[model samples]
Target: MSSDLCGSRLFLALPDDILTIITSSFSPGDLCNLGLTCPGLDSFMSSHKVWLFQCDKLGLVPYTTLIEWRKGVFSYKALCRFLVNIQPMIGTWVHRNPELRHVVYVMPGFLSVVGCRIIPQEIGPLGLEDGPILWTPVFEILCNHVGSTSFFLHGKERGVDYVYPGLLKSVDRDCNVLLLEVEHRHQRGGGKLADLKNFTHEADNEVSSSQRIVGRKWTEKPFICLESDDRELLLEFVTSQVRDIVPDAANVLLFPRPRIDAVDSQQDFIVLHERRLLLLQMYERGNMNHDLKSDEGSPLNPTELGSSEISKSVDCTCNYPASQAAETKEFYSCKHWPYMYESLSAFYKFPIRAPKACDEEYAGLWGGTFGLPPSADKPGKPLFLIYISYEESEGKQQMIANKILDGKSRLSPFNGSTMFIVNIDEPSMTIFPWNTDQQSNPISVMQSFKGEGICYWSRHRYPSIEPGSLFVLENGLLVYLWEHAREVLTLKRLYLGELLKRGERLPSFPPVLNFAHLTS
Candidate 1:
C-alpha cells in the first residue's frame, strides 16, 4: 500500500488483460488519473472495453443504445465526456409555478436529453397502476457530432409549433439554476436566425407595391436599413421572407404585426421580421448582459391594436410595470407556455406510467399542511388530507381524488366521483364533474363549483386559484391547492402504517381505514 510497493516494476508488469479488468471498476476520473501514472496503464485505458464499461455505468441510455450513440461521437471516451457533463441533469426537475404538480422528467432523447412536463390529469377507471401519464416536450439539449451541446426549446404560438434554438451554458457539477436564454444574433454573422436579416429591399418594394401594409405606421417598424428612406422597404421585404416559415405572425414580430391587407400571403414575412428583431434582443442580452427590465415593453400599445396611426403611438411609453408584463415581446417567448413543457417521463427513479395509470412514482399516501395566502390577511393554517388512486368506473379507467380531511371543516368527506378522465398523452386535464342528478354536462362555471376538484392543467402558474389543484416539484414534493384560497398542502410519500404508528390519523377515519383503499 506504500509508495515502495506502488513503485515496484512488477506492478506495472501486470498483464494488460488483468489491468483492464481491475480498471474496469474505476470511474472515468480515476481511469484518467491511472493512465497518467505510466505508459503501460495509458495503453490499456484506451481499450474499447475499458471505455465501454464506463459508458454502461453511466446508465444514461441502454448499453445497446449507448453503443449506437457512440458511433456518432468521436469515441467511447468522447461519449462519456458528453454523458458525464449532462449527468446531473438526468433526473427529476420541478418549478414552483402554475399548479405545483407541474413535474418535469428529464430523459434521453436522440443523442440528447429532453426535459418533459407531466401534466396533471384524472386517473381513469384503470386506477393508478395501469394508466398513461400525459406529457409534453419542454426543452432539449443535444450533443453534436463533436460532443458540444445545443439547446432547443419546443413551443407553440397561435397554434403554430416552433423550435427556438440556442446554446446551453456550461453546467456546473452542482448546478442549481436552469437559465434558458432565447437564441439571439446581436453581432454581425452571429446566430442562424440573425442571418435572415439580409433579405433585400427589392423584395420589399415588390410586396409593398403589390400589397401595402394596411394600417401600420412606418415608425412602428424595427430599425431596418441604415438609410431612413430605404428602411420601410427593407423591413417589408424581410417580413415576406418570415411569413414563409411562421404562418401566424400577428404577434410574432419584434413590434406588433403591421395592420396589413393580404395578411395570409405576407404572414410569414412579418413573423420573420419580428423573429429577427427578437434574435437581435437575444444577441444584445448575451453580449451586453442587457437587463430584462430594459426590454420589458411590447412594441404595441393597447390602443394600437389595429391602428394605422403608428406614427402617433411611436413616441408613447407604457404605464405598466416591467416585472408584471407578459412575455409576448421576448425572443422565442412561446417556450414559456406551460402545456408545451411536457417531456417523455422515461428518466427517473419512478416515472409516471402510461397516461392515467398510476405508478410507484406518485401512487402512495402523502401528507401536508396548507397556509392561507399572504394576501388573504386571514389567520389560520389548515391541514389537507388527500388520497389519489386509480379506479374503474363502468368500463373505463379513472383517476380519483378523495378528500378525507379539510382542516377547516373535517365533517364532510368527499363522496368519490369521477374528477378527470385518465389521459396519458397530454400535459393538462379537463375536469368533467357531472351534475349530482344528471349523467352528462359538467358544471357550467368553475366559480360556482362547490366540490373541490381540479379543472384544467395550465403550463403557467395559476396562483390565483386555491385548494383542490395539484402540482409536483422536482425534489419530490407534491403540492395540492384549494379553490379560491391561498392555503396549500405540501406532501411527501409516506408509509401510512408508519405514520399511523407515529400517531397520525383523520378525525372520523381509523388509521387502518384512512389509507386502506390506496392499494385497491
Candidate 2:
C-alpha cells in the first residue's frame, strides 16, 4: 500500500503472459501511465493487442464486433475515436412537442448509426415482451473507413421511400437542442458538404451569394447571417444536383430493442444483424464513397460531392481543386420537402439527463400525471412530460415549464407554450394544501415561487395560464396549485425511457399505420 510496494521490482518482473493479463486489468488511463514508465513497456503497450484490450474495456460493443470494426479504421486507436465520438448519440431522444411524440432511439449499425422514430399510439393487449414497438427509419449517420460521419435522412414521397443524403460537418458532444432546417453550400470545386456555410429557415429564404460561413452554428437558422442574393439557386441546386435520392423498400426493421432483453427483441436482433450488413453493401453499390479495404492515414477529407457518386445523374463539371477554387462561394440549396423531419431527428443531440439530489441544473426534463381519487380510474390518467428552462424577462429570473407529452384525450396546446411561469423572486403566500406530501411523508419545501398554472380549459379548445403558486419539494417534486380551480399538479424529475421500460409493455400499431406516421 506504500510507495515501497508501489515501486517494487516484483510487479515489473512478471512474465509476459502474466504481464499482459495484469495490463489488461488496468484502466485505460492507468495503462497509458504504465506504458510511459519505460521504453520496453512503451513498445509493448503500443501493440495493437493492447489497444484492442483497452477498446474492449469500454464495453460498448462486444469483443467479436470490435474485431470486425477494426478493419474500417486506421488503427484500434482510431476505432476507439469513432466509438467515443458516437457514444453520446446511442440512446433515447425525445421532444417536448406533442406533434408525433418525437421519440427517437439511436443505436449502432454496421459501421453506422441508425435513428428510428417510435410512433405514438395506445398499445394493444399483447404487452411489452410479446408486443412490438412500431417505428420507422428516420435518418442514419454512416461512417467512412477513416471514421468521418455522413448524414442521410429517410422519408416517403409520391408513394416511394427514399434516402436523402447530406454532409455532417461535425457533432457537438453536449448539444441540447434538436432542430430541422435547410442548409446551402457553394457548388464550386469538389468541396465536400463539411465546408458548407449557408443556412435558412424559410422554405424560400434568400441567401446572399457573398455569405461565407466560417465555423459551426450552434443555434437555429435565424442566428446564421445570410445575404439576400439568389433565392432560387440554393434550393434548386440542392434538389437537382447533389440532392440525389436512393430508392428504398419498406423495411420495418430499423432498430432492435436490445435494451429490453425480451424474447422477441433478441430474436429480431439476429435478423437485424444480418440485415444491417446487406443494407451496408447495397449503399456501397449505390455510390457511397467508402473504401472498405483502404485505411488511409487521414480520415475522410472530401474534395466535394461534385460529379461524384451522389451526383451521378447530373453532369457535374466542377474541376477546380478544393484548395484552388474561386474566391466567391457558389450556391446550392436543399429544403427538399420530404426529408426535413427525418434529417433533423437523425442527428439527435441527446436524451434527457437525470436530475441530481439537490441544487440540480435549472433546466431539465420533469414529468407528472393527474392524480385520481381512490375511486377514480387509474389507467385513465396519462403521464405528462415537460421541460423546465430558466430565463430572465424584464430583469426577473423566471422558470418556465413547457409541456411535451400528455396522455389525456383532449385538445392539444400550441407549440412552445409554457405550462407555468414562476417568478423566482416572489415567495408564495399560499400555504401547503396538506401537511403530508404525495408519498405520505412529512412535507419539506426547499423553495416556493409565485407562478401561473396552465391547463386544459373546457370552455375553449386552447388552454392559458392562471395564477398559481409553485412549491419545490424535496426529492425533486414540484407541486403547483391553480388558485381558481383549487386543483393541484404534482410532478417530479423523470427519464421517460426508464419510466416506460419499468411499466407495462404495449403493442405497436399495424404495419400500415406505424410506418412513418407523421402527424398532419
Candidate 3:
C-alpha cells in the first residue's frame, strides 16, 4: 500500500478510546483544523465523549458539574462554546458615578452570567468574609436550553419585580463598561432569514446576522444621554416587560460567604439553574403576552398568570422603572451629564488612565468622609464613594470628581453630580489649610492644585461650587478644602472589589427596592 494510504488505514484502525485520548492533546484550534482533513477524523472529533473531556479540561466547571450541566445544553461542545464565550466577562465590572453602588461583580450563575452590585456597608463585628456580602441583582445573561443566550435587566416598579428583555449590542472581549440602553433595530425589507443564518456567528455575538440584515441601519451604540421626558419614556419602554416577584429564600449570595470552599454556592447552582429557566419562561411568556401583569408581583395593574413566575425571575429581583431623565442617562451613558458632548458614545469613555505621581494622578475610585481621619476612639463618618476622572476643557487638562454613591443620603449632592474639578496644569501656590492632619502629624503635601468643590449654600441646602485646593497628601490621602466654607473632605484610595469580597452581607430589600432602589 502507498505510505499515505497506510497512514490513513493505521489512523482509522486505532480504537475509538485511544484515538479520542490522542486527539485530546490537540488544542481546540488544532482539533478543528484536523477535522477538515478527512471524514474519519471529523467524525472522531465530533464524539460526545471527546467533548465531555474537553469541557472538563476547559476548567469553567468541574467534571461532575459538567456532567450535570450537559443535561441542559445541546451538547458538550455547545457547553464549551458557552464557557469560552463568557470567560472574559467573568471578572469584576464597575462605573465612576454613584460611587460605591456601581461596583458590580460579574461571576458564573447556574447556566448564565450574573452581574451583582455590592451594596454600600460597614464592617460588622463578625469581621470581613465572616459576614455575608450584601448584593442585589443587576443583569443576567442567560442561556436557553438550545444554548442561545439572552440579556435581562432586573428592576422593580411599585413593589413588584420585573425583567426587561433586550438584545445585546456586543460583548467586547475587553469591555470595561457594562451599559443598559435601548437599541433601535430597523430590520431590512426583503432580507431572507437564510441570509441572516448564513452570517450567524459563534456564541457571544449579540448582534447577529438577523440583527444585521441587508440595508439595515447600523446603530450599535447604547451610551445615550437621556434628558427629555420622551427619552425617559423611551428608556421605560425598553425595560417594561415580564412582571414577577422575587422570593425571600432566593435572596442568597452569588456564592455563599459563610463557606470557604464555596460548597453551598455550587450546590445552589441547581437553584440558580431553575431560576434561570423560570426567567427564560417569564421572558418568553411576556413576549407572547404583551400585557403580562401579576398582582402577586409587579405593580401597574397586576394580573394572575402563574403564581410563581415573578419571584423566580431574579431570585429576589425587584422590578422598578429604569426612568430618571437626569440619572436615567447616568445609568447607561457615563458622560459628564447635562452637558451634551460632541459624541454621546465618546463621552461615556471616562477614566482614560492618566499617569501616577502627576496632576493626573488623582484618577479612579475613592472612599471619603467628611471631618478628620478615623480614630478608634471615634466613630467614622458616612462613606462617600467617589469616582475621579480626567478631561480636557478648552485647553487645559481637568480632573473631575463625581460622587456615584452616598452612604449617608442620596439627595445630598445628587447621584452623578460632580463633587469637584481641578485644573491639572494649574498648581495652587496657596499654603496648606492645616499643618497637621487628624493624628496631629505634620501634614506633608506631595502636590496641590487650585480647584472648585461642591459646598451647599446652606448645610444640606442649595449646592454651589466654591474655591478649593486639591491636596495630594504625603501619606497617600486626598484632602479637598473648600476655602470659603473652610470645609475639609478627606479621602483614601479604595480597592472596592477587594472590600466587596471581604464585606459583610445584609438582608436584601424587597424586589422593588433591591432591583431599582426606587422605593423607601
Position 94, candidate 2: lDDT: 52
Q: Which stretches of candidate 2 lie over 4 Å from their true place?
A: 1-78, 87-112, 116-136, 143-150, 172-252, 258-266, 288-352, 361-363, 368-383, 389-400, 405-414, 421-451, 460-464, 467-479, 486-520
CA-lDDT, candidates in order? 0.39, 0.49, 0.55
lDDT-sorted candidate list, best first: 3, 2, 1
Q: Per-residue CA lDDT of candidate 3, range 76-182, in tens?
A: 77777677666656654444333234445666666777666667654343323243345667666777776666666666565554455655556555544444444
lDDT of 2 by residue, 1-520 (tens): 5565444355756576777787877766676787788776776766787778777877766797687667665777666656766665666555433445555666676566766555443333442223343456666766665656555555543344545455444455554333332344435552543232222222223322222211122112432232222112222233222223342322544444446456775565565555555454554554443222212321211212221232221221221100100011122211110122322212223324444454336567665654521101123345455667666889988777766455555426642346788888899998766677434668777888899877675664667668999887775677777777666666766543333333333233221122223232
- In terms of TM-score, how similar is model 2 to the real structure? 0.53
Candidate numbers sorted by TM-score from highest down: 3, 2, 1
Clash counts for the predictions, in order: 60, 7, 26
Query: Highest TM-score, which number?
Result: 3
In terms of lDDT, model 3 sits at 0.55
List, residue by residue over 1-520, the lDDT tens digit for candidate 1: 5555555256566776786677778889998887888886777776777888888887766786676567556778877877887876764443322222334556665466766554433323332222233345565566655566655444443344434344565566654334332122244443322222222223354344312221232223432212332332222222211111122431232112223465642564445444444433432342222111211241222222222232222211111000100011112211121122222111112211232343423553343443322111112334333445554556644344443333333222221222322322223332322222122323232221122344333343531222354444444555444544333444545432222222211111111111011111
Which prediction has the highest lDDT against the true structure?
Answer: 3
Model 2: weakest 10-residue lDDT segment is 319-328
Candidate 2, lDDT over the whole model: 0.49
Lowest summed lDDT across 10 adjacent residues in model 1 is found at: 317-326
